[model samples]
Target: MKRNNFHTHVFRCGHAVGDEERMVQAAIENGLVELGFSCHIPMPRYRRHLLKGTIEERSINNIPSFIRKLILGGPNMRMPYSQRHIHLKEVQRVKEKYKDEIQIFQGFEAEYFEDYQDYYQELLDSNTVEYLILGHHFDRSSINERYYGRAILEDKDVLKYASQVVQALETNLYSYVCHPDLFMIGKRTWSPACQEATTQICKKAKELSIPLELNSGGIRRGLREIEGVVNYPYPYDEFWKIASEIGNDVVLGIDAHFPNNFKEENYQNLELFAKRFSLHVIENFTFRKGKSNK
Candidate 1:
């Protein structure tokens, strides 16, 4: 079986630790055959569009997001657009420097933003990015109350998450779905809406053959009591059970925000997640190449 992790991040994405070459060195140390640098993508006009979101209506929810964005000069959430070229240049240099040691890929863990549709296509068309995975972190906008990970008391937001994800998968742009169970972050237990959301996503991904990721980032949060159940914030047991029954193709994503995240324990946990859910996890998928020519 090929050892590869299609999710990773570096200092450019304010929230994570380490740099490009440091991350590459970590992957090589961990024996990763392929390491994908999927830092949060920079939107061309971020603050402009972010202001266009419903942030004003939800002033309180916008504070923390802005804290990182403002204090970090907006590098807190994602790399600023101006830094894109420099970031890619350093990544290209590291990629060339260690080509023989390990395979490195430049990818982005992106959200589905209709405003940036043309930009996403341009990145792919120009070969600026090798592939993209739908992280499904927010609603139409990124930094507002619409963020799916913002609140997780019930299925209301998750249902919306399902709707947006379905639309994204239909575009045939993303290579895989990351953390398909992200919306279950704080839910106490399963519900009908959870079933509806999971089923909707699994059916579409199965039809499109886009593998669903069993991400380990959520595993770092450790287990918690969901009513009587104990499990990670995501890669939720109930969610994966539904996925297992549906027989959707599954893949493991390290969601490596830190360099040390490329270790053996994380991989073991991912496999343990599959075993716990009876998931037939696959190790590879067709890396997407821009929009479908058809």
Candidate 2:
């Protein structure tokens, strides 16, 4: 089977470690056939600053407060317009250097905010980014919107998240949905509401023929144990079970934030999880460049 990981990050994403060259070398050494860099796209400066303040204020008594702060306040976490050009240049150079060894792709893990729709379009129009993966970290691009980590898994929140996923798929901008079950990050239990939300997401993905990613980053972070049950929010077995039932196209994303994360064991774990859930894992999905933005 072909080995590929489309969801990856680099030092540009502030919170992640390593550089693009280091990540590429690691992928080749780890026996991967293809590796795509989907670093976080920069949000507006004002929005980022506001989010940083909010995270700092609420981080006072939070467990993993340092991580939360890093995620929220890390400088250059997202690639601004000027920075993206440099990032793309570096990726192109690396791709040329390793062209014979392994395939390298340039892309971004972007948020689907209607307000920032034009920004994504501009990126696509520039013809520098090869693809975009929708990873909804927030309901909206605005600072006022609730972050997924802080979001309550109420019926309304679930519906809102699912609806956003549907809208994102409709845009046809994303190559796949990264961490489709990410809303379950802070969620303790797999409620009926969670199942319903995932069902809706799976149905839409199946209909659109867009692959949904089973991210391995959650596993690396450790599982959330609730009521004596251990589970990862993104790879939440219940979610993938529903996805399998719906017959949605699935892919394994390492979501590699560090160089060493692209390992054989991680791949084996992802494949094992897919098998347990009865998901049809696609190993060699083609990524075409200069595809229409709309």
**Model 1 lDDT tens row, 16-78:** 999999999999998898888888998877776677674544553656767656444456778
| Residue 183 local lDDT, model 2 | 79
Q: Per-model C-alpha lDDT, please?
A: 0.83, 0.78
Evaluate model 2: give its TM-score.
0.86
Tell me the tens digit of each residue's lDDT in model 2 across 36-127.
99998865554465456456555333335434434554344465444566778889999999999999888889877776677776677776
Checking candidate 2 for backbone clashes, the offending pairs are: none
- Candidate 1's displacement at residue 217, Å, is 0.7
Error of 2 at 131 (Å): 0.3
RMSD of each predicted structure: 1.8, 4.0
CA deviation > 4 Å runs, candidate 2 = 44-77, 80-82, 142-145, 286-294
